[model samples]
Target: MTNEQVIRSFFETVRSGKDPDQAPHYMANEVLAHQINGENRVTVHRTPQNYADHVREMIDAFGTFQLTVEEVISQDPKVYVRWQQRGTHIGEYEGYAPTGKEIIELASAVYRLEECKIVEYWIQIDRLGILEQLKRNQM
Candidate 1:
């Protein structure tokens, strides 16, 4: 599969709440995951199983969210993707109690692939926007 195809499949299978167990097929044994929110950046090392668990956590909070790939651009070893995710807040997330509110999140990531497996990624998501939605009724 091409780099773009790998990223698309990763989103479809692992992130779209379809089947997160397929993470091993797309990610390397040790992957570097960078989370960027404005000026704050943090890096975490992940195995395929760990990545799968992360997706499971997301499912726990969002409850079978729908992810739509908005754009994809690829060069050689790098692929960039923009996606929009929509779901209901059915479980606790980031200290926020579930409010049964519909949440829409926009995220983008640039993934670096080795062979056909994802080796590293830098991602940004609209987490603050989701927090704002969660804070609406509390305030």
Candidate 2:
């Protein structure tokens, strides 16, 4: 599969929390996942199983969600994807209890693929947007 196809499948299957076990099909055995929020950044080493587990946790919290791929661009081994996710807040997140409110999240990621498997990715999420939505309901 091409790098763009790999990313699209990963989002539709693994990231969508539909079939996270499919992570291994698209990700390397050991992958680097970088999370960036403004100037703060953290990198986590993720195995296929670890990545699957993380998706499962999100599914537990968000219930079923719709991930819409807005744009995709590829250059050699790197692919950039911009996406939007919509779901109901059915489970707790970041110390905020589930308010059953509908939530929409926007994020962008750049993934590096080697031999059709994703080896690394850097992702930035609109966390403040999520927090504000949660906070508004709390007041």
lDDT scores in order: 0.90, 0.91
Q: Who wins the lDDT comparison?
A: 2
lDDT of 1: 0.90
| Candidate 1 wrongly placed segments (more than 4 Å) | 137-139
State the lDDT of candidate 2 residue by residue for 1-139, as single tens digits: 7899989999988998889999999999999999997868999999999999998888777888888999999997999999999988899998989988888999999999999999999999999998998898666
Give one digit per residue, the lDDT tens place, for model 1 in 26-53: 9999999999977788999999999889
Q: Per-candidate TM vs. native?
A: 0.95, 0.96
RMSD list, candidates in order: 1.1, 0.9
The true-versus-predicted C-alpha distance at residue 69 of model 2, in Å, is 0.5
Q: How close to the true structure is residue 28 of candidate 2, measured as C-alpha lDDT? A: 94
